[model samples]
Target: MRVMEAALVMMSGEAVVVEAPSVAAGFEALYEAEYAAMVRLARGLVDTTEQAEEIVQDAYTKVFDRWNSLKEPGGYLRTAVVNGSRSELRKREVRRRIGLDRPLDSGPDERDHMVDALAKLSPNRKTALVLRFYADLPEKEIAELMGVRPGTVKSTISRALAELRKEIDR
Candidate 1:
């Protein structure tokens, strides 16, 4: 029994040391692998690419800290990136309300005007639009994410597009 206890202690020590070495390396690999995708995802949420990159970096750091708890680290990273981007966007909106008008680069495509118009929508509508159009997610998936029925997603998208069309025509 004494020998078995000593072996367990030795194994635990070795496990800690082994995990220590891999943690940093694992984070670096995850950072490199997901950096661009996260940034792109963020940019679609917020205005500037630089802000998107910063948010993605922040999300990756959070992911690193909770790496072991994540069953799918990639999904966790994506959620973090999305949350960070939304936070930044909300901050920018507050700043705008206070008269801090930063110059925004309107996206190069004409369709972006539609998206920009969509940004004026309520948060739920905007999220539904971005998920449905930008992410190309099906209405069913978006409904699940937004905790609404699929019909709600469809109606929201339809209403959002109608509003966009009015804005564009005017």
Candidate 2:
């Protein structure tokens, strides 16, 4: 199969190519497979679609640059995207503080309500919840990506769910 058509092996959380798995080919296949997902995860952090897109693009570029050295491209790429997104948000916050750009607060839409609720969560809870619910990752993989233990993932998810319920009921 062509690199673009390769089936991904993700059960154990690695993106494996069914074919030759050349560096370029494997990276290409994995990029096609996970780019949208990485963007979505980034979207949960950054304000605009453009910012999230740029972050994902940068993350993919870095992953491709280091593809030959990566032991687990899938996990590494995911962690990179999350890290990039957080960094973008921080930089954006600084820009807004110094008046480089206007604040992003418009009236809250329905989605904004969810975003508002998630914003109130500690970064730890928010990351775990987003990965578990939005990305549909297994706990083991989320733990690896978040650099936490499996038990921590479980408790984080549990606490986050409870907190979200409280926010929703408010």
Which has the greatest TM-score?
1
- Candidate 1: the clashing residue pairs are none
Q: Mind giving the per-residue lDDT tens digits that candidate 2 earns over 53-73?
A: 998999888887677789999
Candidate 2 lDDT:
0.78
Instruction: Give the per-residue lDDT of model 1 (tens digit) for 47-166.
Output: 778888899889877886687787878777876876786677677678878899664657566346666676676556666778778888899877766668999999998998787778
- Which stretches of candidate 2 lie above 4 Å from their native place? 1-21, 89-103, 106-112
Q: Would you estimate the TM-scores of all the predictions? A: 0.70, 0.69
lDDT of each: 0.73, 0.78
The 10-residue segment with the lowest total lDDT in model 1: 1-10
